[model samples]
Target: MTIIKFLTLTLGATAFLSAQSSPIRSCGKPLHPKTIVQNDAPSGTVSKENKIQVALLLDTSNSMDGLIDQAKSRLWNIVNTLTTLKYNGKAPQVEIALYEYGNDGLQDENFIRQVTPLTQDLDLVSEKLFALKTNGGSEYCGAVIRDASMNLNWDGNEKSMKLIYIAGNEPFDQGRINYKETISKAKSKNIYTNTIFCGDRSEGIQSFWQSGATIGDGKYFNIDSDKKVIYIETPYDVKISEYNSKLNDTYVYYGSRGSEYKNKQMVQDKNAEVQSASSSVERTVAKSRKNAYKNDHWDLVDRAEKDADFISKVKESELPADLKGKSKEEIKKAVAEKSAQRGQIQKEIEVLSKKRQGYIDTEMKKRGNPEADDLGKAIENSVLELAKKKGYSI
Candidate 1:
């Protein structure tokens, strides 16, 4: 399985202008600005650092609202499951890329929209998931997979698990690109491609969904797209939610989008809650995971702590109001204080989350629903199995 890596680059004005002036092409056609960005990786060799990169290509065509809903509601559960994985006693970083295909709302030239490049920023992933709207359109599984595999900076490390899970209800063979070639390209790069058909198993198998998985050495699953997910609430839910709120207060916002990012954090918090209390709890659990709750891009505390010279690089005007006018030493002290507070909250959430998960597991077993084959479970099971084969453990 090939894991998706999100590369954030600070290119020179010349390169930036060139990329802006020329249109990005996918399958020899001009890609929509919102669809894909070409050559986004920083100039250098691709890193072989161990991590799990999974690209989720979903069909957002009409009558697939249930599929989208399942994704939105179960994302945190997937994160929580991934967090438990360890390789050589060290936790591997997880990055996810999102693609939405087969939506009438999108352009025909690129019916597929790269909702996000491979990214470790889970909040950004959540925001993108929430923004998806379903509409009738053509579903091109092969084209999207080829685009992602060709365009994204996938690490070439055989030790890393790189995977593409394309979920749709349409025939596997569609559009201009050939499914066989796409799977072959993925295999050539050591990327595993999985197929998830949101319909009957036999129908999916007959439609080439199972064959797609077989070609790429990945799993095939057919799920009832409209199945309602039931979550068993635990006694730790309230405390966990409270700690999540406290966790938010500890963030020290900075940079131009500081306030906006902070607000987005809260918005996602509410979005999780709206899905279900259990979903919110799972999200907080994800936040507590090691290497999961990163916000160095917009948070002054994280930036200052991660980069010793972060304060020196930023202009005075760019600093948050509270951080402004303070000496470097004073600013460092403030950030340290908030960091300590955040760490404490995260520790508490971690402890409570473990208990919550245990309770849910016990309840599920008792209810005889231990074998629920929902979207999250299917993805988690496949990822864990593949990770284990690649020397990872839970």
Candidate 2:
């Protein structure tokens, strides 16, 4: 099939004037500034444990509503995929950062905004993602790619799998920054820049989306952004959901925003459920893996697990109402009980999740298992392929 690459260059006279002005409408909260830390460790040594760092740069243009919906639905599934990976017989720490570009609601010159920095707090990531809104704006592929590469904290471990996935329908070479140069810089930092074009394969190739991936030594994929994500129902889903509810009851909140963070966890649960039962199940499965789902910032059980002196050092006022009046010894015992209960509940969910996966796999084979051409599948395929090349195993 013949491909047509359209490069439209229309420089509005207002571009320069509006560059210094605020956005006409609010995009979200102010972007937090982060210092860029480069990984300088030698490639042959293991100074620190391996980690998986992924940055998602999405286009929130007026016509990309379907793409956003697919991302929301597939997030938990993506998380589940990561949980299955192991490096040197141990699960690596997973951090995800989010960025939204090609939206006029943003005040930046490139119309790009960082939704969240690379973080282990999955709930915060979910919260920021759901808050994104689309607006008609110029898509600057090169500029956003450059920002994500230079801003977020990327580890320098040679064995670490660091990736940047940028999805959009615009020409890959647009904007003031050249994609080739930006992507080359990313490669020097051991970051692969994957490109997902929300259109036909030929069109994506012609538009230079494929080139973006090639330049950064990463994968290029084309997806039908308008396609609806379908989920297969399994009999094990209901039981898993019940166990997930019991698991939620095992968390002990602490800190100033302890109650608020706990509420956010439930809110993210509802958000996942809103996507589909399959998504909710995927999230519960992710939560069951202690290696992937961690809430040390707010949950006393997780905090104590990481820091032995946390209980003794924590002020009583920071504890939840139920534990505020209790002595440190009593608090420690309570946290221990909750941790033990959480561990057992997690095991039950993990077993059920395995059965659930088996059922889904069998059903898929019966139906010929057509490939899903969406945001999640694109990332999953590329991640596994690149991760294996980095000497990691799934």
TM-score, one value per model: 0.86, 0.87
Ten consecutive residues with minimal summed lDDT in candidate 2?
A: 6-15
| lDDT digits (tens) for residues 126-171 of candidate 2 | 7888787888899988888888888777876777778888898988
Note the clash tally of each candidate: 8, 1
- Candidate 2: residue pairs that collide: 39-156
Candidate 1 off by > 4 Å: 1-48, 369-372
Q: For residues 265-349, write the lDDT of model 1, one tens digit per residue.
A: 9999999899888788888877765455567778777677668888777776777787889887887788889888877777777
Model 2 backbone overlap count: 1
Best by TM-score: 2
> How does candidate 2 score on lDDT?
0.74
Task: Give the residue spans of candidate 2 off by over 4 A.
Answer: 1-48
Query: What is the C-alpha local distance difference test score of candidate 1?
Result: 0.70
